[model samples]
Target: MPRKRPGRVRTKNTNRREALKLSTMAPEDYNVRPGEVKSIACPNCRTWRRIMGETVLKIREHCISDKVADGEKHVTCPGSNQVVIIDIDVSHWQARQNRLLRDAMPQENRRAARQFYKPLPAPAAPVARIHAGVTLETARRAYLAHVEECVRCGTGQHCTRGGALAHRYVLVRKEELARRKAHKQSAPAARKALWDQRGGATVETANNQCRPRLDGAVSEYRGPQVPSKPLRVIA
Candidate 1:
């Protein structure tokens, strides 16, 4: 209950009212204002108890449970009559608490509470399609399967869903054909370039081998061969 104010020295615990020792607590521990019923959860017992005074707040003395006359030894709670001093400004603490509560709310729920918009049901999809990297054969099979199952599709026509599937299949087929054709046309040139590179490498290697050991350069990736004769050790 003791607070920092100019000129008035903080009274010692011995001099405090009700003979209860002073215990400093954070403003968040209890709810209080100029004209509201102040209450706090007892720290030791974890039970909600009304704060005891208007000018100075203190934790009320409380027993654990049954009274002495009940013949049950419930015992008194250790938190009895403990003085609580709220040092922080109540108004400032209240403002910060309000801001925190607002921030904690969900983004959707933070809007006006009076809003009564009904949530729209999610739109369902028809048969899911492989939008990317779909092979031509898979597309063709899917189109054929859809057409077979759909009664609206006939020998020379298709229903809307069947028609859409067929169109996708056609596009995939065209792309696959174009890719294969390009690969076929480029195969000869690719092979020729590969052959030319290999031929040049072969000729250069042959020339290097034919030039003999004039420069003492060892073959790549192969160390020099061991000498056939072991020398006699001179003692």
Candidate 2:
């Protein structure tokens, strides 16, 4: 007969009774660390015990039911180490772990932390050219600035581009003057229309009636005089 090779002996029996209990088990009851041994609330002992090995599948093989001291007799847990089939939500577990890790970080550390980012390419230099359909105000400002800077841009005379820009500026000023004149002419009629809409005549009559009554009250009423009795102090 060949000599029996020495090896680690298995402890704790994964009997049928313990395996049946896992059917009603929830994910919360088990503490899972990815790439590490998983621990669960022992159904038999009602204490946290580690499931055997890094691989969670094939869990029916064995489990560490309870912690044993040197020379102490191992108490076998009623929970089954055998009778396989365990479901693990890997994504949910990873998300939960990440949340916990974030929460554990210090406020200062977390605040300083930045996501990985590639620096944006620098913006291209703006094109140097006159803008199309420039507004009157913009043209006026540019014309004034150009005349102040350039010696050639005098009262009537201007550079080639300046001549075209100056014409646009003059046109804008003329249009603005026309608009202001039209608005001034229409303003009194607009105000009268708004006043009529609000029944201004009735409001004015109410105000006139209130003013006379208020004047009469003001004329009759004298402000309160100082109290006559001044020597009344209780002991």
Candidate 3:
């Protein structure tokens, strides 16, 4: 029989401890210092073994799951071998820190530091409300929408605002109709004028010639006019 082999060792779970540490960590603790190499807790492993280099001063190298001397198995951190970009502008960060520091200081100290900027004063009187720009179609649609709801509303018949809106909508519709009618009438006249300019017979001359012919044919159709009422009544 073959000799029995040792089973693979399992890694310890330090998630709870890492969670506690994360809960207590301050905002400033995450800020990486310029020109300094530091070790931080690995995001995947939750262990303080991830090294941040000073050359780029950002996380470029991933965590390696190395075994401890006790022959225990280390958990395979998923973030291993993944390239991480930790680009932080030091000058902008320092400027933000300085601004925060200034804001936290007393007014007297701030006055000694530099001249403070003041915001513009608000206007004295409240500005009147201005109507938003809208097209004629949009205006007509809005008035119609109000009119539709106003009929079913509890206000019943005394809805003056709805009435006014409806009146305005009707006037708009009338104007639109007038515009369409004028366009229709002008189109034929325009075509006739263009045809006459191109040496064709004018529409007016054609109508004048046709009028007498039509009247004569109508007169020739009937023998004579017969009186509907009594001749005695006429006498």
Worst 10 residues of 2 by lDDT: 53-62
Cα error of candidate 3 at position 183, Å: 1.9
Model 1 residue 99 lDDT?
86
Best by TM-score: 1
lDDT of 3 by residue, 5-80 (tens): 3222132222222122323443243444454343455555655543333232222233345554567665546543
lDDT of each: 0.69, 0.60, 0.51
By TM-score, rank the candidates, best first: 1, 2, 3
Looking at model 2, the pairs that clash are 14-81, 18-80, 60-81, 60-82
Task: Estimate TM-scores for all models.
Answer: 0.40, 0.32, 0.25
Q: Rank the candidates by lDDT, best first.
A: 1, 2, 3
Residue 113, model 1: lDDT of 56
lDDT of 1 by residue, 131-200 (tens): 4867887888888788778777757678778877888888888998999999999999998898788796
Off by over 4 Å in 1: 1-129, 200-235
Candidate 3 ranges with C-alpha deviation above 4 Å: 1-139, 148-158, 201-235
Q: Is candidate 2 or candidate 3 better by lDDT?
A: 2
Candidate 3 positional error at 189, Å: 0.9
